[model samples]
Target: MKKLKILILLLTAAISVSAQGFEHFVTAKGNQLMDGDEPMRFFSWNIPNLNYVEDEMEFGRTNPYDLPTEFEMRDAFETVKRMGGTVIRIYTIPVRNTDFPEDAVTFVEAPGEFNEEAFKVNDMMLALANEYEIRIIFSLLNNWPWMGGRPNYAAFRGKDKDEFWTDKQLIKDFKKTVEFTVNRTNTITGVKYKDDKSILCWETGNELESPYSWTKEIAAYVKRLDKNHLFMDGFFAIDGRTTVMRESLADPNIDIVSSHHYEPNPIKMMKHIDNNLRVVKGQKPYIVGEFGFASTKGMEAVMQKIMAEKDIVGGLTWSIRYHHRDGGFYHHSEPLGNGIYKSFHYPGFHSGLVYDEKDFLDMYRRYAFEIRGMEAGVDEAPNAPKLLEIVESHDIRWQGSAGASGYHVQRSESAEGPWEVIGYNVSDAAIQTFANFHDESAELGKSYYYQVLATNQGGESEPSNVVGPVVYEYQALVDNWVNYGKAFDSKDIELVTGDDRSFKEITSRAKGKKGSEMLYHVEGELVGFKVYAFEENPDTSSLKIEISGDGERWNEADTQTEVYASKEKNYAYQVPKFYQVSEGENIRYIRISFQDVAQIARVELLYK
Candidate 1:
């Protein structure tokens, strides 16, 4: 059997090398990770790796750590395959032996102490990977919870960063574990499984180096043991200096440069990838080891853009286990316990291909197949227009999917290249279009660009083509006052301060329709008081101001604050600190009587 396995590996190696056609690793001059071969996208449904298999037992008697029966493993594997997934990343490294009477067993490969039960679990996972003919990236170490196969060991927990870097024994055990897995083949199942390409890659750890590292010992160890298989030293682009992470990958031992891409801003991710690519000396394949669309601001659009680029070999979203009731990744919903980790459904992994409860899979099934080297359909983009134009006051709009939450509309003077975004606006369902502005700031005569994007519950749509004559002029300043008018006074009631003692003490029963006085609480360390008014009136350049601290001490009539009334329609007044009340003083009413009649609407008080 060993001899037969050797022969198969030799043949497979020859085929793989020859089929590559191009260089072995990514190069700097051309595209990085991707080359002649069609890029392959990988997806992983990571189990948080905190709950031990023993803890997950149906009954205490039956050892749950044993490998899932072949039937069960196949069922799980086939589900992912059906969902159009090409790979799976599992967190199966065991952390403890509860039966041990001494200190909890911490090492993944303790000297002579081997856990057959734990091995069985991993064996099933690998066997299933082969059976389904899907690639697998076995993460060598799970996150903080189950570090190096120890249950709840503080040394491995996320917060205990010091030990993982400093502990000599822990480092030794980690190296041994990788050595054991890469060297030992699974023959216990009597399956003809050997080192197959289906076992695509091995990851050092998931989201490692976030807390910072004192040593590169773990990476060094993997390089020494598995020279044949590629090493994906994990990185989370969220916290680390991306340049540093890319530099770490430059080590001769590291075969693939891997990083996790999770940013709300699409442009940020673009800049990040570009920056990291700068120092990666020669050409080396870079992988966004994991990324996802759940709560990940612009995931879908970003992924679509990145994947379309021929340079990016392939990338993986968070997971395939859409129904991990036990939870997974940065965000996880409920899990489906029906003997399967359902991908689609409420509360499951939001990043699954199939809905856990419903059979609905993403329409991008064709895209998935394409990544795996299958013939695919021509890019069938919907007939959404490339550009849209609207008058200055009107909104630019469009209808799109339920997954779109909002769109970004960018504008530029030139129709050809660089564009600056005026603002990112929301999709107003009431208007039936994703709307945005080229407001009063928009210039007339000059062609200004306009675009609309549909946004949904999941993500945003691509921007539309630039549109516009998109005129912007003062929309007939007809009753410009009425246009921006607001009133704070009424004929029926008058705002008054009964006495001078009422200074700064706003009293109710003094004012407009309901006679409800709006009081300003000058509490705490407040410095001063300010009142704002909005109006859109014409022919008014000056206004008479009235002041009454406590309504009784009327300072007659004064022209304190003035306005050119410009073409805009807002006015403000700062009630002087001299009019301010002490802790014991009772200050009140303030009234503004315009000497030149102008329209006024809405009023506000601001702290200075």
Candidate 2:
């Protein structure tokens, strides 16, 4: 069996190399991707929803703000360029969910049925990518059924989801989708799909949990269709990624080894990098197809190691958020924090939002240059300090972290203001006193907002927790809020103080479920609520609003009463909707969720 495998590999290698006849092609030399002789090491990320459309289907999972526009693609590619990225991974197939058949707007509606309208989405994507001079790693299939995945295809063939991994009939049917996509013409650009230089490679699937032999079959099949591009396995580096990569690389059809890393422990992330380096040392060219942070811990360390390794081609972050998308500001992958902005699938290209974005962009820019064998970049991003105390209208105090070289302060008169830096190097002892920075400019008669950010060589971290137009003495306090009950974790309501329900506040976007109501206790009576919200799909979602006192029971008059949102409240909305609680009725607790998928932009409780 071993001898037969070796014999097959040799023949496959000869065929793949000779079949290449394109202007730009990517081939793997040991531990390096070379374009003929010029090495290709990339800094990249994934836009799983690149060829996406809001056809009222959840084929591509969306957020409150979805980037389903063609210009959004332009904005995304521009962002990639700005971040110093040259390549990106995009999902070519929109896996259909069996549960929502109406939402099945995929390349293949049924087996062998090519949807031209749907496939045109890919045409536009490639055209846009070509314009940007950015390359794509198109993921052809998915392991999960969220997007009409392997199971959807298998079920269409009258087989179980598990059958997709081993059944020949199922595999053959999947290959049809591959053959169709690999050969389809890009009508928009007047170019053949297989001839497009925008495509870097075709991944077998996204995070497949199938057998090693199955990946070999698909990888081999994709190679026969398009020899111009390399192939990769979607095997996540969790249990036996190293071993599976070795096994997959043995097939000459498989040109690159792709691994995923999401370890939060700095030590584990560091170790993962070392092992990835060791595994691909003399064997195959490797790239971390995906690595990300749900939070800020250990991410810098992980990035530092990935960038430092010479053998590793480069790493791609989990995703890039596009403009005007469904999810609000960022993906809800982890607890939303300063640097923990879903590791960079930013929601939109809209400017003026105070995301410590420069620091994030700087990190990628530096590493992108690093992979190209070029020396570039300045300071690593510093850690943001925690705001400890607000001494009324006078001094603002905070605590610094190890990574930050200094801290900068900005004060605003309103939530949306022309902010000015009040202090710099506040955390740097040599430059100024650490932690305690006096706001000499604070005026007692007017309200003032402040933002504190930590800075280092790479850039500045996200603003501190106490970003404020902080209310001074009983100016309707919005402090003390928590996630009472919800399907997903949301930010504290106190993070939202201003009337502007923009994307910056962590509490802006919250989720609700069918028949599940969320609870929250505010410091004051809820005279009214300004729930800036919208349905993911108005047709599928509905609103249910109710309030309570002490969070246990409903208003004194009615326990089951609900204030259904008016027609105008379905999509774009304004602030608080007041409810007459009848004199002395409890209005301290706000209970709101939905009958289906929904987004709470900014939950504001009006104190009487």
Candidate 3:
């Protein structure tokens, strides 16, 4: 009886450990990544906004830099899982730049100071990574000024950009960042980041253009601090430098060697990959850290080369952006090679047809499974979407599901009962910065509850949380730049149409110079007006709205607008401004003058 009791206790302890601990940590074994006994290979994506964001250019939002919410982090992981991706590389941890706004949030506030709130955001991401069974490669810094990096560090000490590679104080400051990140404990899961298995490796930086001395120093420091995770050499411009690459592979501290390939020609890209592979074939694992923006066939050819080469571990596409917690997917327009390809969303959409987005995504999904020697099958149903807000009978927005391609909106008289489908196969990606579906057939006098179901190739999700009892009262004169002269007229303004590549709508911009104006004629009494405007540089651009009973005379309307700015050069950040009319006032015409270069996306005139 005592022996039996001992066996029972031992079994219980084993079960407890199994339940609490992760299965395995990814380890390096002679040019291959191993997950326990099996080799690990992945065809994944670079999720730049995983830890920090540079592309939160949404409508009505002033600040672009934001910490990812739990909903957003989960959506990213879930999307990776559905894509059959086992790994993702997050962009660098951000540092403060002198050019940023004083109120901007970043991970490293000063040399030794850190932002706890930003680190908490990373904590949630690591927790969700473990839950979703996906691995992460955490890049430590950036080479460019998009987010602060070596130059910023140099600026901190009043040194030149190249001095970052040689200056002792600048290097020490960078090491402080590394040590803080590696030694910190996750606040949510009670696991120290150094000991967590979710991290696949620690990259020195994103495309660092440093000398061998700096690379060797940083690699040694990272390996000394964290023994569990592997180290990757994040050198920039991998243009067939086999001798330099061979030397990097020989370093004991550097466990992985990677290259970023943006070559448009598939033949040249393959040659470069082959040369790099030959240098590190049996010494260490090699990966194409970032690759894409080629023709569909060109990209396919490059992916095929990676799969054919046994020594090459895997490749991560340039990037993939996910749905925002607010409503729509985060977007970034790559301003290279004709500036056509934007960041890709899952399951593809019609707006991205110029880049063969749907076909390329389909090919990626197939190759993701093929590289693992598994057959691509049906995916699971997406999680239920969240109905965000209902402005009126026509304007309804919702937070989109991760892998969902389209949505089904249903309506009913009561909150709980039989529902009728009002929208079928409505795409959330059709609209940019927000996911919306219009109820064109809603009765004028009826108040009804509404719910949404997300759908894809797999299946349909359960109904979303009910939102409603919205009554159609006032008819809003909504002009999404489509009805230009019907309800509004403009002076020195040009209606820009066609594939703008950012939003699926028309826009009107100043033609020659500043002081271009738009005049809207309202039929009935005006309650208020909401205007969506885009400014490349909000610091230099201004929009003034005025009201008038007669076209000749005008008075400045009392307006409420948010202050907007961005560090991005030539990025058209968007924000909405609202102007309320005084009660019992005879207001019929509204005039808006644009200062500097500004574009208007939409205007809604509410009337009684």
Candidate 4:
């Protein structure tokens, strides 16, 4: 019996040591995230709703979203574990529902009290993460009020939302919550929550636009209680250029440089990564904590190459949603779904809506694995495109390269000798549509040799087949183009629209929902629409564009899929403007409802 007891004690010690060692707690080592001697690299997921629960009837929340059952939570983590995912980023705080307008369930229920159920759910979340060997980054708060964020926190202290950073009492209250959360004993492991190894880092909040001092203070507070884990400043490029980025990068307590990206242009996306990498300056590793497009687009290669070449720590896609609960592959997300989805859910892809679908998750896995050092065959030499036209003049068209960003249309006097750049950045188009390129240098009907080469971040592809001694002529893109007057011109269109009141008199509200007036009259095959934001960029989550006929019943537009607002105010450059063919029934009224009342700029419609 003595021998058996001694053996059992040895095994327990070994187990404890193993967990501690693997917590491997990552630290920045000259731009590389290192764990012990082995470099720490990962492909992770941003699961904003991992701990979300159906609003308990007593909370007065009336949240329509369903919470994942304990079993579902296990399955979710298990699936991530199987998919080569090393980390799971989850939201630890749930705040007010900005859209529906209600109280929300939060880890910190009040000034000094913690929600019993919320904590229990987190205990389960941490345990499951530990069981699956997945590390977690817990975000403590939110920027927007959707999750009862800063606003809710301040309201609880009887202070204005902006006072969250400066109010001494409020800051102290924040420390109390932080102390309780980090020091609280885990119900599952019997180990204190802060001491557990499953947690990777503590984030101050989700893209919060708060003061840098507040972040430093909170991070200091957290470190005082639990010195084991790393800290992250949830600094986002929202509002105008501010000290947020500099403060975050220079802060000693913050361990990682995290930037969220949503740019569609590949060139811009790569640059965004570069900008983030530049700030780290080798003192810390960087991660694109969030980024997304409806599809792989052409990122499979760009992301893998940059991560490996730049020695980036890792990337967490915008989100992963429960297959069964959050609407399947084809389910519509908030702002309402666009009969067809691009995979980003309603909330966090900027406006919080990030969920799953079969193809989308598979794409996520493809990039995830690629980022983890798996070889993806995206760098192979692209096949030479077959030039669709034999042209010697300025106007020309050709096939697109499979993995190319743009093409170089070259001009040569000989069929086999030298080629000069006639045009470049000729955009890549769909497989079925030929790319159009023009050379202003070409004389009409001139005999010239032309060959095109595909270009991408990877490198240039083999020159396309030569098309020579061909004559070409300029083709006008449009004939007799006319600018129809704005939506205010009632005589030019069927509907006369105004919001709440005349556009000039309206004062924009940063919070709560604002609405646009209805334009009613007649209807033509309502062809397309153009719109932009007015002044300061609005919150991406706060906008609704609906078409109502008879000034009564209404339907939302597909373009609304992209809210005019983004977490980064300037990324939106101008208001959200788009032109698309209208679907559904013809309506008499057009109305728009969204947050950020001041963001509206202009709206115009075109019809024949």
| Candidate that scores best on TM-score | 3
Give candidate 3's error at residue 541 in angstroms: 8.4
Query: How many residue pairs clash in each candidate at the backbone level?
Result: 51, 27, 0, 27
Query: What would the per-residue lDDT of candidate 3 be over residues 1-608, giving only the tens digit for each residue?
Result: 99999998898656433433358888999989999999998899999898887766565455567888888888888888888898989988888888766667898888988999999988888888888888899999898766678888888888998999999999999999999999998887767788888889999888888888899999999989998999998888464543235568878999998988777778988888877766676688888898888898999899888998888899999788888776767766776645667788888887678888888888898889889998768777889999976758647888889889889999998999589999997877666654366676676678889999999888999999998778777656666664355447887877664335333222232332487888888777787777766554435436788888777788888776654444333244343433344432777888888766666667777665
The TM-score measured for candidate 3 stands at: 0.87
How would you order the candidates by TM-score, starting with the best? 3, 2, 4, 1
lDDT, candidate 4, 1-608, per-residue tens: 99999998898667555544254665667667766687767776777667874211111112333445565576467557545678988865664333432333456667777777777788888877777878888888777665557776788766788888899987877777777778877676655778777788888888877777888888888888888888877877521232137666677788776777665556666676776656666667677776655345545544664556665778776555432321111111222122223323211121122223433444555666666667433344444555656542323666444434467888887888588987775643211011155455665445678888877555788888888776544311210111223232122122212231122211121122354332423344344454433334433434555665566677777764333222221111223322232553565455545444434333434322
Q: In model 1, where do residues sit more than 4 Å from their true spots?
A: 1-69, 97-112, 146-161, 189-194, 210-216, 239-244, 264-275, 278-282, 293-297, 322-360, 373-608
Candidate 1 C-alpha lDDT tens digits along 1-608: 99999999898667544433223232222234322254445433433322222212111111222233343344345545654566666654555433332333333434335565556556666655655666666676655443333222324334254465556665555555667766665544332222444455676666665333422566666656655455665654541255436456546655566666555456777666566556454356666665543332354455565566554555665443221121111112222212222223211222232333222234344445656666534322222223334653434443332223245566777666477766564422211011223243454456666665544333455667667545553221101111122233334334432221111111111222322232223222222223322223323422333444454465533333323222111112112111122122232334544433222222322111
- Which one wins by lDDT: 3 or 4? 3
TM-score of each: 0.45, 0.60, 0.87, 0.54
Error of 2 at 392 (Å): 36
Query: Considering summed lDDT, which 10 consecutive residues are worst modelled in model 3?
Result: 503-512
Residue 149 in candidate 2, Cα distance off native in Å? 1.4
Question: Distance (Å) between predicted and true CA of 536, model 4?
Answer: 30
